[model samples]
Structure formats: structure tokens, C-alpha cells
Target: MAMGNSVKAPLGHIQFCEENRSACRGRDNSPVVVKLTEARWNELIDLNTRINRQIRPVTDEKLFGKLEYWTYPRGGAGDCEEYVLEKQRALLAAGWPKSALLITVAKDVKNAGHAVLTVRTDQGDMILDNQIEAVLPWYSTPYRYIKRQSTREPAKWTGISDTRVTTVGSVGN
Candidate 1:
């Protein structure tokens, strides 16, 4: 994805960072793109599939009775944000560089706001979505790319300048 100038992080993500400060602190020297090894590729695919099956897709309003409450799917259910966070956390615990796993916001096929995990590797930028089973290249997905966590600073975000998109602007959840 072509990331534009720095942009404001989604409100949910801002609040999430406030609640989980440690996760937001990324090392300045962490690799922005990962070296995609066969083993690491398998791990990404496996983790995406496992999380898709493990968490029931429930909106934050339904689960937390509040909007934009980013959290883990500890209750076996959560929204898209929860799935992304869980994947990011798991990958980090498995020794994946923090800069390589990013929290991304986008407009799905339906043009609705959605959260996903964007894994940046030497091969390409692949997306792990709760709504999709396959781990796909960011361009392969039908999202109108919005913004994502900066590789240099997880607490900051940058806009996505999607060449294929011009019709969509702004975000809603």
C-alpha cells in the first residue's frame, strides 16, 4: 500500500493505545518489513485461519455495549479490531517484529469500516482479516484502504493512498 502523509489514528485505536501503552511503543530500529521465510509464511497463514475460526464475529456494540472498544477476543467473541489485536499480539509473542505487524483500518467490500492486521514482509503486504479466510495481499482484498499504524511508531498512523480507489472517503464503524 502507498502510505501518504501522517494521519490521525482511528479513535478506537487511540483509546486502545491509552489503555495499552506498552503495545504502542515500537522500537525505532525495528524492521518495517519482515523477511518472509517459509516458516514465517506458514505461521501467518495458520494464525489467521485459527483466529478466524476461534473468534465469533460480534460487533463491539453487541459485546461491550459500546462502540470502538478495541480488545482481545477473550470471551470467544469480538469485532474485527479484536481479531487484529489478537493476531498482532500472538505474532509479537512468537518473536515477529512489532513494525511488521500493523493495525489497519479500511472500508470493506460493503464500504463499511473494518479493522484488519496488515503483515508487511519482504514478499508483500498481506492482510489478515476476520471476514476473510485467506491471507491475501493488501491489493488483492476489496478494501478501500484508509490508514494504518506507522511502522516506526505503532501509536501513530498514516493514510493509505490506494490507487484503485477514489470513490470512498472518511470512515464509519
Candidate 2:
């Protein structure tokens, strides 16, 4: 998928990271405006690039092991969950609002399990995945949504796959 199409979402419709722009004016203090700044947005992009280096794609010959919500620092190689979890932690350290980061699962190009990040901004939803460094829209990603866990609970998020997707609840629930 083209990076331009994904990143070029309607800024008016989604949360956006505006640094020099004064997007927040009152006490309501929307989390999106609070977490994402122009500087932090750039940092997320940079961090995503750095994390991509650790990703080793899942292949039959590569060997594998079981992973779950409790495994900390899943180590050198991981499936989508570990990959996205690490990136989420990096974003938090960079000062991006934790609320802005979403741990989402989508159908991979092969119609298998896959994972990516969903960042909500006043501009729209921006997707960040090791597969692509541009941080495009979730829709722009080739994967289709199977599940999404609020960034607030990265480690707490359970089962993120097509099989469990059918039984999961909505974000607000």
C-alpha cells in the first residue's frame, strides 16, 4: 500500500499532533492534544524506525515459541504482539500520550495474523508498523482490523488474533 494514501487522512476528523499550533485552549485537556506534539509525532516516527530493526518475520524455518501478555522483553525475535508492545513502550518514554497509542491486530497480507500500531490524532488514525516506517492510516495498512486494545493497557491486553477477535468487546466496554 502507498504511504501517502495512509498518512493523508482528514486532519479535521482525527486527533493530530500539533506542536507550534495551539490546539488545546481549555481545562478539558483532551488526551490526544496532551500526548501528541509535533515534536513527539516525529519522535514516534523515528522510534518506529529504530524498533523495526529488531523484528524478525515469522516463517516456518525460523522456529517459534509461545508468547502471552505476561512475557516481559520477549527477546530478539517475536511475533506481532511483542513487536508492537516494545514500540509502545518506546513511545511512552518519548513523551507521547499513552492514550494515543493503540495495540491493534489486523489480517496480514497472507490472510494470517498480524499486528500494528494505531495512533489517534485530531487529524485521524495513523498506523505505525515495523513493516512500514511512514506511520500511515490504519486503513492504509494492508491488514484488516481483527482486534484493538487501548494503549492504556499494553501488557494487560489479552488475545489479539483472528480467532479471539470474534469474542472480544469494544474499546469503551
Candidate 3:
């Protein structure tokens, strides 16, 4: 589906993006146009599962005693955005193209804001969510898609056009 134009990121995400500009910057600031192999797919799934299981979920208010949105590579506990940042870093370190890994924000079934890592592959755009153990296509998730980091520029973000409700399912990338 064609996505909407670029949009402003959430305040918290904006803060995180600013603080970690160097980390987010990529050698090539373009969308991924390659297909992923089965081995690469398995590696991504393993990394997602490992980080999700390793990091205990904690709200920013509880952890910081304030409503702040920041992303970091936390070892023990962190919120959704932190999880996404960690996964993105790991994938990049593992030699995955930066354009393929995007940090995305969406609303959950209850309309609560959430974050997930969107992996763009030749097959489709797949999501690695902290709430679910499995990697699934972005369209199959329960969340209402919103904006995601722009492929042309990691610092910029674009709005998503697909708002169709999808049943939760596992789909390989």
C-alpha cells in the first residue's frame, strides 16, 4: 500500500532521535530493496526473541518517575521504544542494511501507543513487536499502523495509509 506523507514523530521519540543521531545515521539513507534469506530471517527472529525475553517491561513513569520517551540499549528492563532501539542496533551491527530496519510507532488494540521495529524485506514489511514473540507482516498485526521512520531519511518519519483492522497472525518475511 502507498503510505502518506512524512509526519512529526512523537515527542519522546523525537528526544530519543536527537540524543542518538549518530547511531541512527546510516551510510545509505534509502529504502531497502533486497530480499532476506532464510538464515537472515532466523537471525532476526532470534534477536527479537532474545531481547524481548531479556528485557523486563517497565513503564517510563515507573522507571524514571517522569513521562519521558527515550531509546537506549538497556540490559535488564525498558519500555517498547528501548526494545526497538536495541533490536535496531543489533541488526545494524550484524551487517543488516540500516534502510531495512525502521523504528515504527503504532496504536494497540486498546488505542494505546506502542513501538515496534519494522523490517523491510523484498517479501513484505515485517514487524518485530515486543508484545509478541513471533515476527509477522506489518498488515497482520493487531495494532493500527501510524507513522514510521522514513526510508529516505532515518531522522524523518512518514505516515502509514493502511488502517484496516487485521487479525493477529504469524507470517514469515
Candidate 4:
């Protein structure tokens, strides 16, 4: 897929860190920091469950040059990234703060990279994954998160792990 084919994610998830320091620091982004009351959180969870159904978990063509739409083996397929992207849009359409949503890249215990959505609440962070929509705790995921960018800030993110996973020659040009 080309640039035009690239789907636009929610505004809160696309922050540029250097340009939006306030948001990157996890401050002052309306969409990223939802002020949802307890009732709203429960409502959001319901909405997420409905949206999660549209996504199917698959592992195909992950290293194909630059992945555009998370594809499956049967020609057209969407992985967790595409699934989370669509889920975020659905919640936004249903009147949820985009800031309360996050897209995270993490490595599972098997070291396979995976993507999932994070929902911030007064209690703690709730995770929405293609594998399930029960909204689990962040630590409940058996994956080690590498980085995450909020929809409120497109370019800025945090929580990158060490580079030892790759060889030094793969680090720079």
C-alpha cells in the first residue's frame, strides 16, 4: 500500500513528541486523558467489546518491507494494528475521548512483536487486544511493551526498551 492508502488513525494517537511536549509528557491532551466517570468506563468497555469482534488475530507477512495494512496470509487480512486502529475510530465515533486510548508495541514472552490498545482510567490502564476485549490490566499482558504513542499526539511516544535485541550493525546506516 502507498501513502494514500495509509489510514488516518485518531487525532489523539498521532502526536509528534518534539512538537507536542505537553501531550508527550502525558499532560493536557483532552483526548488522551479521558475524564470518564465510572459509568462511562463501563460503557466504553461495552463499546470496545463490540468493536473487537471485527478484528481477527493473525501472523503473516509481518516483515514484508514496510507493512501498510496489517495483512493476513489469505491476500487481504488485518492484524492487531489495523484492528486497534479501527477500534479507536469506533470509540471516537461513539463519543469517547481519543486521549484515553493508546497504541502500544510490545514483545510477547516468545519475543514476537504485537500491538494492542490501552485504555486509561482512574483505577489503572486497561488493555484491549485482538485476542480479547475484556479490558485487562496493563501487566496482565504477557508481553513486554517497547513503545507507545497516544492518539492525541501522533509523533511522540514513550517506553522504548533496549536495543540489544538487534545486532549493532542493524542500528545505524
> Quick one: best lDDT, which candidate?
1
Task: Give lDDT tens digits, candidate 1, residues 17-127.
Answer: 898999897566645688888998899999999989999988888888897798778689998999999999999999988888999999887889999999998999999
Give candidate 1 regions above 4 Å deviation. 165-173
**Top candidate when judged by TM-score against the true structure:** 1
Better of 1 and 2 by TM-score: 1
- In terms of lDDT, model 4 sits at 0.58
Tell me which of candidates 2 and 3 scores higher on lDDT. Answer: 3
Error of 2 at 108 (Å): 1.6
* Predicted structure 2: lDDT: 0.54
Off-target runs (Cα >4 Å) in candidate 2 are 1-37, 58-64, 67-74, 151-173
Candidate order by lDDT, decreasing, is 1, 3, 4, 2
Candidate number with the higher lDDT (3 or 4) = 3
TM-score-wise, the better of 2 and 4 is: 4
lDDT for model 1 comes to: 0.89
What is the Cα-based lDDT of residue 28 in candidate 1?
Answer: 69
Worst 10-residue lDDT window for candidate 1 reads: 25-34
Stretch of 10 with least lDDT, candidate 4: 1-10
Clash pairs detected, candidate 1: none
Q: What TM-score does candidate 1 get on C-alpha atoms?
A: 0.92
